[model samples]
Target: MVTVSAEESLDHGVPAPMRRGEVFTIHATRDDRSMITHRILPEIAVAQARQLNDAGWQVHISELGGRAFKPSEFYQLLSYKRIG
Candidate 1:
């Protein structure tokens, strides 16, 4: 498993410390595409992912420093609003 420093995890767009093995969630968007990835705490991540998925987003659960990770997930959850 890839270990993430406390500074690397985030909550609510704010940088905060995370436990050694703690994971978090990240939402990303580009043009008309969007996905939610998890580096998330299972307690909350799963629920959040399900919620986003229910809203029609592609949700993925991944490790903190695992493959397919985008650095931006550590920053924020992007808007997934659909266009007309």
Candidate 2:
């Protein structure tokens, strides 16, 4: 079995760090335990989103600007309005 690091892995090795909203991609796959592992394909986006928690970024696959992932059944996209 092979493993890859997260999208930001390369950035950490370079002298320059990534901005909070920077995006990158590597490869992603499902492991033998049926757990999905993100390989961080080098062409995808990894932008910061307040919608996310401490990681503060959103990662998803897309083609033609639409979701490439199978629809979620166990989770729903929660929406909230910033009432400030």
Candidate 3:
């Protein structure tokens, strides 16, 4: 029989999907000190960004890895429309 510790078991575990309205902070690649906060729009915005084939857009909730989304959190920054 094999035994696994809690830390070992959690090592391969995947994170849960992000929820709506969650805030993701975007950092400028050139300037580490600069960051922009963005709230995740509805699911529809994600779908729409994908349909447009804009894969570079990403939504980062924290300081770590970011998830890709079309018309992503960054998109909101570029758009003049009010986001909820």
Candidate 1 has its poorest 10 consecutive residues by lDDT at 75-84
- 1-84, model 2: which lDDT tens digit per residue? 333354332323322212222222212333332222233331222221112212422223322223343223102112212111
Query: How big is the RMSD of model 3?
Result: 14.5
Cα RMSDs of all predictions? 13.7, 13.7, 14.5
TM-score for each model? 0.40, 0.19, 0.25
Tens digits of per-residue lDDT, candidate 3, 1-84, equal 122212211112333223323333332222233334332432333343344334433323331235543233534433443332
C-alpha lDDT score of every prediction, in listed order: 0.44, 0.26, 0.33
Sort the predicted structures by lDDT, highest score first. Answer: 1, 3, 2
How far off is model 1, as Cα RMSD?
Answer: 13.7
What is the total number of backbone clashes in candidate 2?
11
Error of 2 at 49 (Å): 27
Candidate with better lDDT, 1 vs 3: 1
Off by over 4 Å in 3: 1-16, 31-33, 42-84
Cα lDDT for residue 10, model 2?
A: 34
For this target, which candidate reaches the highest TM-score against the unseen true structure? 1
**TM-score pick, better of 1 and 2:** 1
* Candidate 2 deviation (Cα RMSD): 13.7
Q: Considering every candidate listed, which one attains the maximal lDDT? A: 1
